[model samples]
Target: MSVPLTLAHLVWRMKHVHPGSEVVADGTRLRFADLADAIVRMAAGLHRRYGIRQGDRVAVLAFNTLEHLQLMYAVPLLGATLTSLNLRLDSAAMVARADRSRTDLLVVGQEALDHRSVGPAVRAAAAELAGHGITVAAAAELAADVETELPDLREDVTAFRFHTSGTTGPAKSYEVTHRDVVLHALSQSAADASGLRAGDRVLPLVPFCHVNGWGLPFVAALTGASLVLPGHDLTPARIAGMLNAERVTVAAAVPAVWFDVCRHLAELGTAPPAALREVLTGGSAVPRSVVDLVRDVLGAGVATAWGMTETLAVSTYERADPSVRAGRFVSLLEARIDGNSGSPGEQGTLQVRGPFVVGDRDGWFDTGDVASLDEEGRLAVHDRAKDLIKSGGEWIVSAQLEQHLCTHPSVSAAAVVARADPKWTERPVAVLVPRQGRLVDETELRAHVAERFPAFWVPDAFTCVERLPLTPVGKVDKRALRARHADGPVLSPDTPGGTR
Candidate 1:
């Protein structure tokens, strides 16, 4: 029973046991058997036509499509590492990432090639890559008619390389071995954090290019679940339609996507289908209102997870108890609060280590997040270390402020950033996005915060935006916001208070 832990093994298991399972994408449905065959053909085609070999880096620049899913297994089958390029990155950033990853071949999605908004940039990057001897081909052009046997791959061989979101700074690439992927998938499937099960229809609204769609594709293949790909139609309405049409049991996405879906459901006077049981929300903080909405409208429990690109998508899953705000770490993962001298209730930098985790120097990897363990050993992430605002030598967690602001009935979303201050050095500024057709009163918001927090914790100024800018991965783009308002006017106690 000592089988090698490779993605190829997972695919072979699915092909033999769950071959009849369906993977629906873009109104087309294909069985797991067909998918297995296609992957073999694609692997053979890539090797014979493109000369792809073991240890070569294959970069895939695409959206969430069937083709992208195929490459997720096919590239690894050839014993080559797959680097999924972020489609949302600008041309320069995209090219820089490709160069940094040392990609040998670039596979562009046909849809991305034909896209009016992003196609030109992809082509420009492709041309630059071509000049550097990096062969560029459309994913559709890489298929072959002949099947190829899977190459022998070691468990320790690097299977995939993912680039960080680069929200705070330059994006860093992290490699995950075949063993890492297999263990992560098995742990997630067994944990059943999102209530995934065999034959359950699963749809990942997050792109496969992002943390392997939070590892849902692999988890689906492992658990015999039907994988539902949304293709390029990620609109809230479209996603809702697919959820109903496919009777999806489990779904995952960032908080922003769920917000839009809730709005769409409200507009349509509809609720999620009866089959939908769980909605996993992450990528950013999940507002309490969102959790309440999903439970009330969709009748699905919302599970909030916390992880980074380096952690392989998720590390903690909220416990079943509603009173527990923190989540428990998955099996085989160990966590601690760095530099914490107090009891478990004290907050500090969160560090984790496990077989699948990266950046472990001395058996501990700093997560760059401030967290605390409750009496029940559940983790509560307060805020990112870089996002904390220091005023007069005191740290103010921005996530706490954002969460309180989102509780306001009229606010749809909120982001807090540190604004440079002449006296305080850094002051908290609140950015509010109002609910549709609702006007936000700065005086009312100030009063709301003034009641919950001390005078110092209240934001010095408030800015209302139609929509907060988000990073490519859908988290609030606080760095961009800080850069935009860093040199702007700062409000003080002596200044008159009004909405900007």
Candidate 2:
């Protein structure tokens, strides 16, 4: 049997199976049917009143909320693609993305009133679209009474356009089909198949702009699960309070958010929240310390995910081996191992090719990440194939540097990147966030690195930051770091120079 990609099937299933169940807690209660009805009505209204149609791209400029989640259902009702616009990106990037998607409409909510209206690029696109006659809707003014009927979309129609952070470079755009979205929704449902039962509350701290908000909305809608949208203010205290008060059983976040919230809970003399059953962390490697925090502090298990926007959502997950279960980790997705080009315990790139993995090579969609797969099938993401530092033409894993820092007593967090140099072509640099308000200088850090690594592999420079700038999705904003320090002094291969 083949799965047909359509919101209709999901809505019907939910309405029949658990219609009266609360599907979303967007600061208010709404049943799955209530939400589905609203989506159908809006999709109808937009199509009839404003001529919104399928195949056209609809950009949403709001944070994670009930209305934003509604768009996921409503847009596809009209056969239109949803482009979840990142709120943290500049107006310029937004416009560029919108233009790239040829966005025909943008739906924004009232909570966004404090923000300056459509970005200049959006304004320009709006002006251009208006010249050709297009409709842009503000939430307060939209009504579901319009009488327009929407057409059924083709099975393979594109449903969304996801954008990469361009953290390493300029962000690239990719289109996700209705099939991709549907498959992602189903895939994520499988991940939630463990301890979470129907109606279990799952708090989503991840932003909605990313890969269908990592496909959270779809999973909840289909599974008759409840969703708690935490808006844009992601303070650790706020999330911690929600977890405790709401008795949220499951949640998803990047390591950074997890770290901060865990810190807040610890400060309050609390653990990872007794109500929390499982925590899904991704957006980079799962530090050994983080794994320990999730296990010891929260008394919960951790599942690490791997993927990119192009994959629509997760392709790999960290799980424990069934037979051994001796605290050995494993990835559920299809994977293979390759050469490490480093040292012992340091393995090679974990190459993968699966239906969910997307990238173009000759014709394949390579994920561009170099990783390692243990005998147990656990995947440790080493570095971006493009970002790996090559010293004397031998690869120096930057992730290894970060892993070393995470284990250090004084370090709270670290990001290691390659600096372009004339001699080695590129060398490592360590940008860090210290733990417990510790003050760490360059000499002290270099000395620390020298103790663990060969002198040549030591970072040529160290930049201490109050906090690493994060992308909208909450990963360290390495792009911002390079923009600030790309012109910093270069170290000579002949001597160690970052001493002052």
Highest-TM-score candidate: 1
The number of the candidate with the highest lDDT is: 1
Clashing pairs in 2: 48-148, 54-79, 339-348, 340-348, 350-371, 359-364, 359-365, 359-366, 360-365
Whole-model lDDT per candidate: 0.83, 0.68
Residue 433 C-alpha lDDT in model 2: 69
> Candidate 1 on 1-500: residue-level lDDT in tens?
57789998788867898898989988789999888888888999899998888898899888888889999988888989998888788888888878744788999998887787778888888888888888888888788998876678888888898888988888888888899998988878875454577779998888887889999999888888999988766788888888888998889898888888888898888966778888887888888777777877677888888888888988788846321355888777888898888487899999999988866635889989888998777888888999999998898999989999988988878899998878988999887777877767777899999899988999987877767899988988988888775556644434433243
All-Cα superposition RMSD per candidate: 2.8, 5.0
Tens-digit lDDT track for model 2 on 373-419?
55544556767776688988888877778877766666677888778
Off by over 4 Å in 1: 319-326, 489-500
